[model samples]
Target: MPSHETTPAESVWDYPRPPALQRDPRRIVVECAGQILADTTGALKIMETSHPPVFYVPPGDVRTDLLRASSHHTWCEWKGRADFWDILVGSDIRALAAWSYSDPRPPYEDLVGHFAFYAGRVDRCTVDGYTVRPQEGDFYGGWITPEVRGPFKGGTHTHGW
Candidate 1:
């Protein structure tokens, strides 16, 4: 009957590897719209955002061929140097749909040189086999990882999504 509950295994409040972000660096991939971009196992899922999770994958894992450098940029107090990328879809190019950390501050060195994509710009986004829906009003995907459960965006429980 409680709106919130905790399990011995895990909970949103406490993550096992808190500060040090670890990426599988195996066979992780992301696809959006009809574009099959980013195919690398080595990706770091940073927990800097609380409402939704954001993942930063190395540029090598990302399909840079379809990406265009953008003038737009955002800064994080913890992380450093957030660069933006525009996605090229045929004749149309979406602006500021992707970002990367050219230089990162201490404690977030692993995320350095890695990039994160904005789910909102793409028609669709997927990780492994599960489909991820972009978070509203933000650049994040809630469905690319295994840590999520029910009541996700686009789910039956999500009336607003």
Candidate 2:
């Protein structure tokens, strides 16, 4: 478990809108195609209302050499534009498995150069040794930890949420 956890489990409903970014000390390890995609104890989490926290690993901690920039892009009202990456491993190419805000908007600039992977796309993702459940649906990338309470965004009929 992460020693930095100072409070009880958090309810996503209590997370603020526009989101909040805070440094996290928990060990985060992600695996994909039987490879260690990323490993870090220094991570950041983006918390938003109705959503579990999204963990972002610093670019330096990720296996960037195994990732390629893809043409896919997305826009977020809070984080601005994000670019996707495809994971290339041993004759296998996983498309759009990771994303980063190469140039995030103000307030979210700290996320620039950091990468967040889709838990469902990767073989597995663990926080403090606990495997995470990917946020429902394909549109979001929140990692559902036991410490998070959610009526989370994503899944069917949550488009306007």
Candidate 3:
């Protein structure tokens, strides 16, 4: 396991290996091309070791019309297969900018149909009004906020972890 000094903030190194989900009451807002795609307080945050949290927003709080199904699909050993979605804001399109597990396996079944966006791919992603930095790497969707500390795993050198 990676070792780092612990402060008052939560450390990514201490997160569980298989990941765990928790309700996040903070407002999560996603915007692109001056349009709001998702705004919700009813989000579930998944925490995993060496990674920032990935917030899953409920479908009811998102603009369903702006999301178009994409051809991309990926499998997670823990969460099962994920389906991708492209975000369209007027003429601007970000292909496979979001994803969700439409039929997740046990323990992650609550995530079915809940969407998680790529913070770097969107114009902006905010948690409780604080802008979030996207987790490094194209495949991971974790969002790094001020309260979460990491020498995170998704970057090039850390992939071997």
Candidate 4:
């Protein structure tokens, strides 16, 4: 059984099933290879049931020069197809560390062209000074923050969730 020892702010279980995008004004930062890859207050967060919120940063806030398009793509029934990117900082390379929905489907169209990074693959991902924990599965890029409590659904035993 998953512990429900969550903060008083929000519960992941209460999130919606189809997911909803909301503008998050919190400061979001991504750092890797001793460099700041992205920093922004204008981020969009996707909230869904049994999953931590995923923050999407605007392209203008990211260091685009450090990213190279990878030959990776994935489909999401709600958001549409996503394109991956390899983060190249100096000589260090993190393959498929980031992704974007270039042309999202309805309701999620605001995510088009915005980027979301994998907290596990990056040196650090912080929101409002809280370090984020990456969603357990390699395929999901949700970022778990302190204010959200979860019996999140990405780990080994959560397959059926």
Candidate 5:
């Protein structure tokens, strides 16, 4: 018999949240050492992928000044070129903790320049001061906004983490 530890939970695709639940959105505020880098509105439900919830910010609402283009680049099958950034706080730096698409595929153009940062690398993370704990998949800090809720994987499930 397979050990319980080895048995993975059903893939998220196999356990889809209800339509109403899936539609619910969360807002994410990403900060580095101390300054607010991105205050993204109309962000959708945080999904746990091989990485993290990715905090899909609508392109128009994101603050671009917080980002400085870097030499980093990674590829995404669905999105396209993912450009990276080093988040700057005062004079301190967290290397490659943030990334976004400058020119995404047609389907994802709305997210252009809307970046996502790894929550674990940052000094402080707060979703409206709720103090998010790191999720199982990746380094992400999240705030479950009014539209987002229920059976969230990273909330109480990852308390000690």
Candidate 6:
């Protein structure tokens, strides 16, 4: 058993309905499918209620050559339409492992073409050298580092919240 107590610096419940986007200068790295997928210190982080921070890495920092665009698309009330990106390395193909918004809603225009990944769908994710724990459950692609405590929403019984 693990301790669940926290004196959190930020609470997901306190996050705004519209979410807040900010430039995060910490080193973010993703290694998956036996490849170094992306790395950058110039990522933007999105904070929303009941979710861990979602870091969006600029395209220039990613291995764009390894990505194959997927026809799949989903709508986010705040971020506008999102297009899924599949990772292709040799014969391995990971579907819908990452997402990008080529044209974001007004508040998130800075995120255009930035890649946000699902840690659970990949091998590993890290922030400033601390290994990241993917937000529980499947839908949300949040990065949970040591600093952020949460009653995160992606786990069981936390849906539609």
Tens digits of per-residue lDDT for model 4, 60-79: 99999999999999998889
Model 1, CA-based lDDT: 0.62
In order, the Cα lDDT scores of the candidates are: 0.62, 0.92, 0.92, 0.92, 0.54, 0.89
Q: Residue by residue across 1-161, what tens digits does model 6's lDDT show?
A: 22324424777778787999999998899998888999999999999988999999999999999899999999999998999999988988889999999999998999999999999888889887778899998788898876676889999998867
Error of 4 at 48 (Å): 1.0
* Runs in model 1 lying further than 4 Å from the true structure: 1-10, 15-20, 25-27, 139-146, 149-161
Q: What is the per-residue lDDT of model 2 for residues 1-161, given as tens digits with 9 covering 90 to 100?
A: 54536648899999999899999998999999999999999999999999888999999999999999999999999899989999999898989999999889989889989999999999999999889999998877999997898788898988897
Number of backbone collisions per candidate: 5, 0, 0, 0, 1, 0
The list of candidate 6 runs beyond 4 A from truth reads 1-8
> TM-score of each candidate?
0.72, 0.94, 0.94, 0.94, 0.61, 0.92
lDDT for residue 58 in candidate 3, whole number 0-100: 98
Clashing pairs in 3: none
Clashes of 4: 0
- lDDT, candidate 6, at 64: 92
> Model 3, residue 3: displacement in angstroms?
28
Candidate 2 to truth, TM: 0.94
Candidate RMSDs in Å, in order, are: 7.0, 2.1, 4.7, 4.1, 9.9, 3.6
Residue 48 displacement (Å), model 2? 0.4
